[model samples]
Target: MALIPVDAALERVLEGINPLPAEEIPLHDGMGRVLASPLHALRTQPPFNASAMDGYAVRASDTLDERRDLSVIGEAAAGARFPGSMGQGQAVRIFTGAPVPDGADAVLIQENAESVSDRTIRAAKPVEHGRHIRQAGMDFHAGDLLLEQGRRLDPGALTLAASSGHARLLVHRRPRVAVLATGNELVNPGETTGQDSIVASNSYGIAAIAKEEGAEIIDLGIASDNDQHLSSLFAKARDTAADILVTLGGASVGKHDLVRGALAEAGMELSFWKVAMRPGKPLISGRMGAMHVLGLPGNPVSSLVCAELFLRPLVAHMQGARHEPDMRSAALGAPLRANDERQDYIRAVVRHTAEGMIATPFTRQDSSQLTAYATANCLIIRKPHAPAANTGDDCRILMLHR
Candidate 1:
């Protein structure tokens, strides 16, 4: 098969995909979850005219003069309303969030009033109508549309929903991803390693990405190159009912690279393989039943790059989120050479300069260099077959960090 372009490969990876079913969860657990349906206010906020400050609720006409004395008729505290209505030259001592007493059109702040006696107070300054009062439904009215579908419930959103009388919210279920690492030459971290063995580090990074993108992860540990062992791991993924199965290594066509063959044997209908992208060219994607499978390269940098480009978006999409890569324009901080057919994502350090953002690509871009990838804050994108450029030329980059 011909090498698929980067954009085309991403399109194929997301084709026919839809968000998972919605689930109702408590408001406390709704943060970062996407709304599955529009949120309508169940009850009006400030259901009644209420005080916005600790003051005396009086008729605007009663306190219009520079100096006026009014009888203190009643007191209204939060959650308690004064039963009697105010008469002419009458006022009610009110606290913040307290309901405005009947027949009171304004609140005279205590700062501008002086207590004349236990039952009377003198307004030292004129008061305007509706001053220091929150009108009924000021924040939101019952049945008003507060949050739209697909909105992520951040802190503010959760507070709004709660104040609108919502104890529960309908949100998209978190996507469950199963991660499997394959390599006979790999051993778990913290384990004593032989001279020829290296630690399996890719799965932990992949799992972190999945978690940050709102996916619950099931780590399937390590699977050797043996077909039976790979098959057992695939069975575990199926049993977990994972939305996506991510294989950390064994994607290339090498003799020991058995991930693709094992997934095929496990009944994955291959979508596409070998994208036209450097460092991640051997990426593999397919599906078996409802579970999607992605085979990433063994190299640490390549595995992480592929995960950033593909896995994050997939998980966000499954959660009914609107995911877009943070692509930005920058000036080249160094000279570059012409590119080949495969597109290049050069790891770079991005800094804000007086001119603009400057992206300086690392000197060595070997796929196995994890330290450089960890230190870089951005990926400078070079299109396939692009011409050479000098320092200070315009370029596009994908920001990896804030």
Candidate 2:
């Protein structure tokens, strides 16, 4: 079968992907969660007109004259209120955040005043009405939308919600992913490997990626190439109520590659397979009822690349995040060879240069090398049928870190 282009494959996988239903959660547990409903201000901010300076609050007209000096009628500190109203030539010593006196219209900062006595002060500058005064609901008003749906909660959001009188938030529940690694020759990393068997490592990396995208993981330990074992694992995945199922390896034509078949037997509607991407051509995606199933290639590097290119977005979108690969343009540090019919994601090291960004590919481009993938900070994307590139050639690179 001919391989599908990268964009088309991505479009297929992302079509109709949206966050699940929302749920109400306590404020303490809402950090890093996506909002499912709009957050509204329940009360006005700075509930009353307040002072913004630790000085005197006086009627603006009281200081209109050139040599206006005023007597302090009363004092108002934070958490204290001045009872009497102020008239011309009368002032209130008010601290920051204290409610402004009824007749006071402005504040003369301490730096702009000279204390004549315990109950009097001389103004060094003219005061303006509403100056240094915070009006009621200045930050937010009751019934105003404070945060929209799909907004990710950060520290600032938390503070805003708290100030807006919200003790809890309605947020999307974190999706759960069931990760299963399939193959007869794969063993657990902690177990001693035989001459012909290798440790199953792709699931660990993919699991971490899913969790980082805010999805909880249910690792369905390594399953050998057996029909019964594969069937049982799928059943367990369903029982765990996973929102997504990721199967590592056994997604290709090999006799022992039974992931696709097992999923189809379990009623999965195959979406697509064989994307036109080097090292990850055999990747497959499908859906079983409401659950998404992703078939990742057997090669460690291929599995990771597929996860970044595909799985990350699926999981992020499931939680209503605008997810996309972190791609940026860069200049080549060295000459690169031509690409085949598939788009090549060449593992590379990115560096800052006097001219601009530069990416140099690793010496070996083997699909099985996990060390190279780990060492690479970027992937130089080469389009299908693209010719060789020379030093300083412009190219698009996917940054591993933001």
Candidate 3:
């Protein structure tokens, strides 16, 4: 099959995808969850015209003259509103958040009012109408859509939901991702191994990336290069009802690459198996029943780049949240050679200077080098068949998590 452009490949992966079914969860547990329905305010904020600061509530006309003394009436504290009304020459002692008494149009802040006697307070400053008062529905009104559908509930959003009288929220379910690694030479971290054995590291990075995007990970561990091992892991992933089955390594057409055959046998309808990208060219996209499948290359950098480019969006879209990478313009720190047909995501160290963002691509961009990927803070996007550029040339960069 011909290599597919990166954008076309991603389009294929996300075609016809919709958010998962919604489930109601407590508002306290709503952080990072996507809203399934529009959140409307249950009641008007402030409920009534209330004092914005500790002050004396009075009729605006009564306190307009700083020389005039107003008679003090009943006090109105928060949660204990003054039931009676206030009229000309009447001032109610009100604290912050207290409901302004009826007929009172303004609050003379305590700093601007002086106590003349036990029953009288004099205005030190002219009290204007509506001054220091929070009117009803100032923040939000009942039936107002405060949060739209598919909005991610961040710290502020959760607080807003609570303030809007939402004890619970309807949110899209978190995407479930099952990760499986393949190869006879692969061993788990911290495990004893002989010659020719290499510790498997891609799954950890992949799982971390998925989790950062609010995905629940089910680690299928390492599968040796054999049909039986690969097929059994595939079954486990299906039995676990994973939303996306991510297989590491074994995505290419090499002799030991068995993941493709196993997934195809397990009823996976293959979408494509190659992308026109340098580090992550052997990427795969498919689906089995309702579960999506992605086969990533074995190289460490390749797997992570693919995860950022493809898997992150897949997980985010599944939960009705947007997780696109942060892309921005920058100046090249050094000269770069012409790019090949495949798009290149060069790991680079980015710096902030008087000249704005400066991204310097690492000299070595081997797919197996995890050290470079870890230390780099951004990826310089070098388009396919591009000509050489100098140090000061403008370039585009994708900011990494670091």
- Best candidate according to TM-score: 3
Off by over 4 Å in 1: none
Q: Provide the TM-score for each candidate, comma-separated.
A: 0.94, 0.91, 0.97
Q: Residues 28-113, candidate 1, lDDT per residue (tens digit)? A: 99888999999999999889999999989998888777567899988999999999898899999999999999899999999988
Q: Which RMSD does model 3 reach against the true structure?
A: 1.4
> What is the TM-score ranking, best to worst?
3, 1, 2
Model 3 agreement with the true structure over 44-149: per-residue lDDT tens digits: 8978998999989998888768889999989999999998988789999999999999989999899988999999999987878899999999999999999999
Clashes of each: 0, 0, 0
RMSD of 2: 2.3
lDDT of 2 by residue, 1-402 (tens): 578999898888989988888889888887888898889999999899999989999888877774767998999988889988888899988899999999889998888887888888888888798999999999989999989888888899999999989998998889899999988898898898999999898989999888888888999998989978998999999999989999998999988889888889999999998999988999989899988989999899999999999998888788887786788989998898888899999999999988889999998999999898998999999999999999899999999863
Q: Which segments of model 2 are wrong by more than 4 Å? A: 64-66
